[model samples]
Target: MSYLFIILLAAVLVYIIFFRKKVVKAAEIAGVNYDELLDVHVPFYRFLELNEKNRFEKRVREFFREVRIEGVGTEVTDVDRVLIAASAVIPIFGFPEWKYKNLTNVILYPDTFDGEFQFEGGNRNILGMVGSGYMNGQMLLSRAALVRGFSSAAGKENTAIHEFVHLLDKSDGATDGVPANLQPPAFAAPWLHLMHVEMRRISAGKSDINPYALTNEAEFFAVAAEYFFEKPRQLQQKHPELYASLSSIFGQDPADGGGR
Candidate 1:
């Protein structure tokens, strides 16, 4: 064998031993059939060709390996794990080298809870959240909302995707929606202008984009990302400029079959 091939083989062997083994064990415990899970549950995977699907699968495995997932009040099944990993993978598939450095663990709850992880009267239906302050590098997800997010094809409210988008927004040390890591300095002004105009339109109920996006630029970006991935064609049709901006940041165009 060639030296390069030998070296690559060694690297793969090392990865399998040190990383892949742990993920395989986790999947076994969860009884996860990844191929079946992706085929049945993950809608975004439907758009990928075979080669891309393989890459996506690898990313999913790697995500599960790197991030620790624990159930708080529910048992995490293979489907639940797959859904969570898919949420993380779908958003960053366009950026091959990207990692959720700020994210290390995912805590799954049976349902939405308050910041202290307590369910109350008014704060009952939160879907998912990315952590900050003492809870940094963590994510909390509602199992029911998570299932519902991917179970339907009607709305752009995938809780997992929303929180992952927030993590991406937080990558540059802030989640102000500017995405300093992704946004070029020169493009910041135009991006802000676009956000303002869209927020106004949403406030006026003139746009079909989610009104929740009007909460702030940070939420606007996350909500827009959910639409970008879940309803790409509609987003591109109605808000081409915003879609283009998202395309620039994510480095892919879902409207164009995931940009090959």
Candidate 2:
């Protein structure tokens, strides 16, 4: 790698470590109140029962302890951190011992960014991305998309959760779509078969799942997860096999009492 790139990576790593220490200290002293804000803002949080909510809160706290969240050109808020943590926790809520070891930090841009990672000027269609190579162990999210994803009117397309699912898919060493860490060995063939069948339906314009899923196997997994978590009942009714597969993989069945 170029000396300049190595220096930049080192700088990011240093800042993340420092920021995490500060957050942990502040949390211990002040005791962050995730309830009022999470209840007021997050729909998924509200859908959870008292016990599940407690577990969710604990997981969110654990997320803050393990990973750092910082704004790129914007300021990160308590609400922002909670929402981001919720996105991470939602996909893995099924796995009590699960942790985002592949992700050490998240960078929230003010809005959409381009291929060059510029938030202004160039094409900015990308809303969220999992960093790789020199940027591995980090994630980028658009502030606008993050907020909207939690909004009641946002529908099944949750940008933040979608990216986190990609991270989950990557936990097994690749983001090829079959999350070996989460799924059983018997799952690979069945899931791929289901994925292809669904992709064909999407291509024919007959699927309620997003067409973005047709992009690739990885994208399909992420997009399907957004639907699974956002509209569990609907997804369960419409796509029983896919929903069942995801339920087995994630362990939580939001369709039934938040699947605690």
Candidate 3:
């Protein structure tokens, strides 16, 4: 029995090591040129610098290596690289466990992609989806939105970060915005309470955050995350309590660049 146990343990160790290496390799193949990434978005350096402060920086690099960008139209110029990097990093910032794991592919359109949906009445129609951050495993963004977000430096309404935040929220099997891993016993009450209060305020138009956050809890979380990174000062100034709760849940301080 003891020998059998040892064998099982060894097998588990081997699997972990092998799987992790494969992930790293995949990431390398998918990563874009560092210089190209910088040229497209000047803020990319700041983000990279921030990542350097945390032990997770190396892992973040590896993760990017594995991500592939496809279906981007001609509108995707060199400048769009920053959006790609921001989309890749911001979501993982709140969930470091995603390192070495592929979050699937990112499909970029020139701007907002036309989406078609079928109504219950059997009528099929297409609608223009225009937004900075739209996520469903596949993240869609407008090139103009990406530029505005980076140039602003306020970080209050980053579409890439916002959409990816949704991806993180849905990682645990649901899009409810409450990431399961973040729902520790200690945080349960505070997260729920703050979310409820802030969401209500936004709905009432009493908050500076986008009113779309009032759509649901999941959206509340994603929109809050966008403000947390893009517009930290504004979010803190307007919603101190909500900012504090987010700081705790994400395990890092955007105000301080803890995880960058």
Q: Which candidate tops lDDT? A: 2
- Per-residue lDDT of candidate 1, residues 93-173 (tens digit): 988988888888898998888767765457676678888789888899999888988877548678789999999888888
Tens digits of per-residue lDDT for model 2 on 1-260? 99999999999999999887887646642556898878988878888889989999999888887887888889888888989999999998888999899999899999999978899986899999999999999999999999999887788889999999999999999999999998778989989999999999999998999998999999999999999888898999999999999888788788986521
Assess each prediction's global lDDT (C-alpha) against the native.
Answer: 0.86, 0.90, 0.60
Ranking by TM-score: 2, 1, 3
Model 3, span 36-148: residue lDDT tens: 55534544346445444243344445545565454455344434644565556655655655642425555555444444322223442311122223443355555556566
> Model 2: runs farther than 4 Å from truth?
1-20, 23-31, 258-260
Give the C-alpha lDDT of model 3: 0.60
Of 2 and 3, the candidate ahead on TM-score is 2
Q: TM-score for all predictions?
A: 0.86, 0.89, 0.68
Clashing pairs in 2: none
Ten-residue region with minimum lDDT total, candidate 3: 124-133
Best by TM-score: 2
